[model samples]
Target: MADTTGPISTLPGAHHSVPAGVMCDDHPDRPATHRVQGETDSFGCELIDMCDECHGEWKAYRDTPQGGVCDWCGKHADKLRPRRDYEEGMYGRVYDVCVPCITRANQEAEEELERSGWYD
Candidate 1:
């Protein structure tokens, strides 16, 4: 039988237990909301964004820079290729691939299309 559980979210790693404070930017007492960011304020101690992950100020910290260490998903790894491709689509700009995901995806697609009677 399939396990019926609560809804799964893309955003994992939720630590909402703020210590007794509004949170100083560089408080050693504060735990960083972004585990993978390795972020720090002007000071040496870790910085706490409104959303430590996204830096949404009102909700969390707002409009954070992309390419920050994404603690949310493991989409990125150490071997990320340097170049990327962009394309115009029905929904605006879309990523064709980032070289690596492209290579893997292309190979998979080719094999899928090559199945018996697929091209026939």
Candidate 2:
């Protein structure tokens, strides 16, 4: 679980917070009043500032039927993730990709890391 206890601190491992009136990270038109923590299965332990409406929308998206054709493999997937590649601080086009393709990509990255002998 995420630790959301205490005042805002810049210390290491501290949970950062954005006060109200700040623009919602997902929705520019909305004002953020809450912070959403990242989960293990989803993303890193980063805190995202969101408004109540945006939060509800996020929940609705998660509750939606996870059925879509993967753009990477052109195959039907039970769960398609919105994947994007970042280069030079800019994000590329987002692709609805299958879990299997993501797993394969991770495996390839791991193999490449091992071959590079960075851990040795």
Candidate 3:
């Protein structure tokens, strides 16, 4: 697991504190207490900020399952799809992925290809 000691500052040109009047992306009314930066399964490699509630939601998404932790969604479950030469853009890597994450990634990739007129 990565060092989650404090609010990660991976956002470009972002300050340490949440700006005034900013609300949580998950909850529209609640004030954002924490700024979270992490990876998403289908959203490609990047960091995003979240409120405390959303942070909790993200943590739940990354919870370990019975088999092991998923490299994509970070969830743990009974079944995981293992890949030996998973091409992660700039590098070829090996990791175990949860079913839902794999499904979502496939769907997202198909959508992108369709949008590019390559999946027809």
Best of the candidates, lDDT: 2
Task: List, residue by residue over 67-95, the lDDT tens digit for candidate 1.
Answer: 42222233654333222222322222222
* lDDT pick, better of 2 and 3: 2
Model 1 residue runs over 4 Å out of place are 1-93
What are the lDDT figures for the candidates, one per model?
A: 0.33, 0.60, 0.54
Clashing pairs for model 3 are 65-76, 65-77
TM-score of each: 0.24, 0.54, 0.39
Question: Which ranges of candidate 2 are over 4 A from the true structure?
Answer: 1-31, 34-50, 85-90
Report RMSD (Å) for each prediction in the order shown: 14.4, 9.9, 13.5
lDDT computed for candidate 1 = 0.33
For model 2, state the Cα shift of residue 88 in Å. Answer: 9.3
Top candidate when judged by TM-score against the true structure: 2
Tens-place lDDT digits, model 3, residues 1-120:
111223222322222455566676667777766554443232322334467767777678656443878887777778775442224442233357788887877787788889999856
Q: Whole-model lDDT, candidate 3? A: 0.54
Runs of candidate 3 with Cα error greater than 4 angstroms are 1-66, 84-91
